[model samples]
Target: MKQTSFTEDQLTDALRALKADTSDERFRLLTSEPPKARIRPLLWYGVAASVAMLIVAASIWQSSWSIHPDTTPTATTATVDENLSQLVGQSIAAQTQAQQQRTLTNDIVSEHLSLVEP
Candidate 1:
């Protein structure tokens, strides 16, 4: 009966003698695509939190501000008005002084230039 198992001599002969085989087809290089990222809930939560904060801030600011203030002028408002008027008067005086100084400087420069030319 022929032996079903391979002997040491048969294995050695198979290993030493090269079996004929041909693969003329060039090797095909394959690249696997990267896995798509899943949307996280944390990002949406952050956006919602920011929107909520903005809404709250806007509501607070709107509630605090008034377009039409109380018409009843108190003593403090009277003083503030007086102070504003004084500030306006002082600024006007300073502007006039600055204009006069500028005119004087220009006159001096023109006189100097005229003397240098002669």
Candidate 2:
């Protein structure tokens, strides 16, 4: 028997099409059946949700701006200038130390090369 196998996507698409056709017929059928969903309750739910979200957003914004303790420039200008000068001095010292270390290493490498060549 030559059995035909369908892929998952093909089966899902077939089921989806069937469901759509049946739903369309059901909606078109004019019977005394209760409605599936009421529009008025859903509309009210959406309005209530929108109002709650607006209130929450407004409170968040107002709270964020309120009681802002001047967090910036906590350090005085005198201390900042002192710290800047100190940093500059430390940077200069570090460069001088690095140059001296490089000079020493170069001299040692050249001495080793000379011995190796001879």
Candidate 3:
């Protein structure tokens, strides 16, 4: 004979036993505690304050900003020429300094090597 897992009667009996022993005790205990009241006044007050703040902020921003015509030259020919001359001068100075540094470094190395030999 093949041994089968829990028979239908056994399963039904176990379920019935569990149902009989279980109670709504925990649910009753939780519900017995006082329910928290919703504060509608505070919510309305916050919304009103936010709307008032936005109105004040918008008025201030509108008062501060104004549309005006451009006054000064954005890209004058003389200004561009001046900028170019300044950049060229800076580049020439940088190159001259770099060359001087290289010559000085080479001289120092040669002097040190000569001292170390014979």
Candidate 4:
């Protein structure tokens, strides 16, 4: 087995070499300026997107309101009431017909059973 250790002088020399390889001036130059030219286009794109969204929202709002113009609620209510009453009358007539059919079926079934029993 072998154990390796760095002495203080060797560690100091390695650190000095590493520090000499890195440049502080390059880092300062990279970070000094805000990227204004790139930022302006992105800002304009965002503004254009918001305006487009507003226009779309306004159109949707206008179309929805325009589709159903202002009319008296009573007229719509009366039409709905007439339709509902017709539906109810048809439903009642169908139920009565079904009841009559059931009664006729019951009578026929009872007559056949009686004849079979006799």
Candidate 5:
């Protein structure tokens, strides 16, 4: 192999060029900027826990509203029922009166026909 030699001045100029290329302002700025903030695992866990708690609370509230226990009958309800029964009784009495009147008219007509035939 032939021996290759670099002169002292040539080696220094090459090193200077390499140093200048490596020290670019754009590369320095990119490296110097602070790193972006990252979300923590604990924060995600807390959010999940809060959502679960809210769901549980909502379910409990809904169930409590839906399941109603029977209470004592109110006076207003009793009075309404009483009025309804009275109206039904009045309707039945009116029907009975109408039926009796029809029966009386039929009897009178039959009696008149018998007298005329005899």
Candidate 6:
């Protein structure tokens, strides 16, 4: 009697048997379950959206203020002048004080140098 090679029908039957195994079914079921969501990317997208919204709102608010020419609420002229004078006076005082300090420092430095040389 001659030993026979497996035919196409026999191969198909074996493949079907393998697929019908309980372990294979469980593995397939487990693998086929929906993938879990990654929290990092989702959180990043949400943060990006919030940042984008804040930027848009800021731009819109800035635009609204700039769009209407009449919306520039006028400052009282007297108050503006007074504030300006005060700031200018403060600046002048600071400059004067700085000059005085520089003069004093120069005198001290010259005195020290003369004393060292003598």
**The best candidate in terms of lDDT:** 4
- Tens digit of lDDT per residue, candidate 4, span 3-107? 247778877877787753347887887768678976999999999999999999999988866776874434677797998999999999999999999999999
Model 5 is weakest, by summed lDDT over 10 consecutive residues, at: 68-77
Give a tens-digit lDDT track for model 1, residues 7-114.
Answer: 999878878797554444322212333233234566778899999999999997766554435533344767879989999999999999999999999999999999
Q: How accurate locally is residue 35 in candidate 1, as Cα lDDT from 0 to 100?
A: 36
- For model 1, the run of ten residues with the poorest summed lDDT: 25-34
Cα RMSDs of all predictions?
A: 21.1, 25.7, 25.7, 18.9, 13.6, 19.2
Error of 3 at 19 (Å): 99
| lDDT (Cα, tens digit) per residue for candidate 6, span 12-92 | 887787755468778898777454546677888999999999999999988877876664546566887899999999999
Give the Cα lDDT of each candidate: 0.75, 0.80, 0.78, 0.84, 0.79, 0.83
What range of 10 consecutive residues in model 4 has the weakest lDDT sum?
68-77
Q: What is the lDDT of residue 46 in candidate 2?
A: 100
Task: Give candidate 5's whole-model lDDT.
Answer: 0.79
Q: What is the TM-score of each candidate against the true structure?
A: 0.37, 0.39, 0.38, 0.38, 0.36, 0.39
Error of 5 at 25 (Å): 43
The CA-based lDDT of model 3 is what? 0.78
Q: Give the poorly placed runs of model 4, Cα more than 4 Å off.
A: 1-75
Flag clash pairs in model 5: none
Name the regions of candidate 1 deviating beyond 4 angstroms. 1-75
- Displacement of residue 36 (Cα, Å) in model 3 is 87
Most TM-score-accurate candidate:
6
